[model samples]
Target: MTRHPEVLWAQRSHKIYLTIALPDAKDVVIKCDPEGVFSFSATRADGESFKFDLELYGGILLEGSKINTGLRNIICSIKKENKVWWKRLLKSEGKPAPYIKVDWNKWCDESESDTHDSDDDYIRGNSEDNDSSEDDGLLYLPDLEKARRN
Candidate 1:
């Protein structure tokens, strides 16, 4: 399977949802079960290919570990795509699905050629930002036990 142009990206949250147009094949493979270890290929209509296999956490985490690693890899991969397909997807679609929004200024900087290291840096920064926001969210929410008792 080759990565399709349709796949602007994917999010492996409670469930895996892709911001991609449903391929003619109707289903896309996700490496969620084994957690951080996964391999899948997608093909564009023109036969271009994108394949990924991730073994994050040194391949030794439990279910939560898998979920976190999978999510990280997925976002990093999409960010490397330069967000070009995202614009195309928006132009042809019903509504924009949530994708890890890329920082275009940093992403397409003239000093940087597209490369894995740069993308990794971006992912690291993005993850930090996400953590801060999630922390703020927790502060505003009622305690889980109290809510459950209510």
Candidate 2:
């Protein structure tokens, strides 16, 4: 029997990111259609077969999509036909498959999407500012020295 790999997905307005968590995959085959159908198949190093099919929430730009295979996963960058936020990854109304999940690390809400890009530009434009007050939105541990003094 074929096993299904864990699929983690996140999205921006214009694109979707699908990360297939399958280490050392071999004979990988992936297909995405303009009509929002996606198929994937691969074999693990130990000879286990893995596969899955998904009906995406919206049409995709097959020509603009890209796939990158890595040591631990395969990342597929799918370009959406229309630049809009999708409510969910799959087209179905109910719950998604057990193996499918949201990729919180890469998720960006629609309201934050615009600011997300600008934040990168801001960091690059202000590289010369090294003051502690100018942290680029990253979380840092509390300064123990300052706390002790207080």
lDDT, model 2, position 111: 93
Q: Which regions of candidate 2 fall more than 4 Å away from where they truly are?
A: 117-150
lDDT of each: 0.31, 0.78
Give per-residue CA lDDT, model 1, range 1-150, as digits (tens): 444333333222111222323343222355533333534555444456655543322222233221112221222222111222122212224544343233332333232333423233323322433543221101022458988899
Deviation of model 2 at 144, angstroms: 27
Candidate 1 backbone collisions, by pair: 1-41, 1-42, 2-42, 2-43, 3-42, 3-50
Give candidate 1 regions above 4 Å deviation.
Answer: 1-27, 58-150
The collision pairs in model 2 are none
TM for candidate 2 is 0.77
Most accurate candidate by lDDT? 2
Model 1 clash count equals 6
lDDT, candidate 2, 18-90, per-residue tens? 8899999999999989999999999999999999999999999986566767678887878889989899999
